[model samples]
Target chain A: MSDIFERIREKFPEYFRSSHSNFGDDTILIKPEGLLPVMGYLKDEEGFNVLMDLTCVDYYGEEERFEVVYHLYDLTEKKRLRVKVRLREEEPVVESLSHMWKNANWYEREVWDMFGVKFLNHPNLKRILMYEEFEGHPLRKDYPLRKRQPRVGPLN
Target chain B: MGVKRVVTGVFGEEGFITTKLDSMVGWARKYSLFVYPFVTACCGMEYMSVSCAHYDLDRFGAALPRFSPRQADLLMVVGTISHKIAPVLLRVYEQMTEPKWVIAFGTCTCTGGFYDNYATVQGIDTILPVDVYIPGCPPRPETVLDGIMKLQEKIQNSKQEY
Candidate 1:
């Protein structure tokens, strides 16, 4: 597994920003532009075929304010890998992985809804949990806790 | 005075019981309340237990969980209601006919439980008027029955709005 990490770093030294393994669990942090290629490599070569989960984290007061985490699973090898990408605070945009993994569509939508991260070329990039009229991304650190956006309606 | 006394004696029958029309209507309404279960979270499991055979809600006259809001007189909101779902809940409440009642059936529905954040609505009453609130993370069946009983008492005395 460490050999795979070393090979990936050797192959794409520019994209492979850093990597750390704790308790035999590997986490690779890569550039935003390199997200698709790294993920493709992990799926096709490293056998991390299943996109288990995709979620985001908010780090307040940071230059790159959001971190999108992708958990990949290999059914045959029974191994797991974590891939992360950092995005800017102003306008976070990343390449959509929906083409490679079908379930990336909704996972990306949820991340976009919660973190306000835009996914380029996403087929349907809309709010999954929150409604469309929802004002701000609730998961963002700067978003006010008590702030509420109520939509008036005829109520059927 | 002699004529009034003779009329009263003839009209007032010994076998019949007399009561106000409103009280009769209230009694009928209390015993025949059709409930709509708007279950959305973990509390739904407990609600199922409340409805099922062991703790059957039928004994209290609220047996059927009507899917259509139009058919139901009682709305049992059985779980957490997020801001996103609040509008939907309101829509369902509005669709219910006059003389309707709402029961906030869990701690999440009563006070948003631990989710004091932006996503979850703190309480459902901000959007819809509630008649009864059963406050538990997921109240036991006994507690749910007690809430039903309380609602029944309220219904028994309430004016027939419809």
Candidate 2:
């Protein structure tokens, strides 16, 4: 743990921010609005070139409704950093990281499609995996497993 | 070994069909079919095998996987499509030139299967038009070929109807 911490502390000082925790893994909470700049520095300065995955979890039972996560990997250093930004149920918005990584385009769209976390600068944030007519975000705890919304009117 | 057998295998002769191929599509339906596999998970691996040298889907004109949806006649949805991936699948289906068909390629895409827990769509049919439903945890290559044959038959029969 100390070694990994030192590695980040030594290599990429500009990208590293304050809250480094030991929560199951080396996780950090970044300011929700500052995701773009921080992510940019990670891509531009550090060698963490790949945004391997982007996902969101609904912490429904808890006070926080959502926790959006981005897993960034440095191919050269073989290091991984998990950046997380929590969001309230309503008014959930975060700056997009689409500019830094092309892969983020599809992944961000997916998170938006499933969890409804609005990515502010995402080029195309429309639903990727569901019909435009789907009633509500199914990943949310409120949605039923077997949704029985009736087919209304003409099938378009 | 001979030109005759190659012709029959390539163009699909009426009486020269293998028993598995016979069961896959009707005598006349097995020819001139194109498939586009919408693969996302482990099942996609099986799909590749069926299309590759081993299983040899080329015998029935389905070995070529079309990149452009415009050229494809069939859509083989071959894995667990999350709520995020489902729309993209539908868009691909919509993008396809008409007279199209769909094979719900495995238990996951056909129905959520073991993933009936959370955020998984029970069946892709709820989202798209499905012609044939193939079942297996991750169906074997043989089973997928069988599903393709069935889809070909469905397509042939539908053509005859019109």
The model with the greatest lDDT is 1
Residue pairs of candidate 1 with colliding backbone atoms: none
Q: Cα lDDT for residue B64, model 1? A: 92
TM-score of chain B of 1: 0.89
What is the docking quality class of candidate 1? Answer: acceptable
Give a tens-digit lDDT track for model 1, residues B80-152.
8887778899999999998899999999999888988777877888788999999988899999999999999
Identify the CAPRI category of the predicted complex in candidate 2.
incorrect
DockQ of each: 0.34, 0.12
Cα lDDT tens digits for candidate 2, A1-156:
455556544554554455465665566666676677667766777667998899999998776679899998989988777888888777778878887788889998888888888998789999886667666777887777766332321121
Off by over 4 Å in 2: A1-24, A148-156, B1-135, B138-162
Question: Which candidate achieves the best TM-score against the true structure?
Answer: 1
lDDT of 2 at A70: 90
* Candidate chain B TM-scores, in order: 0.89, 0.78
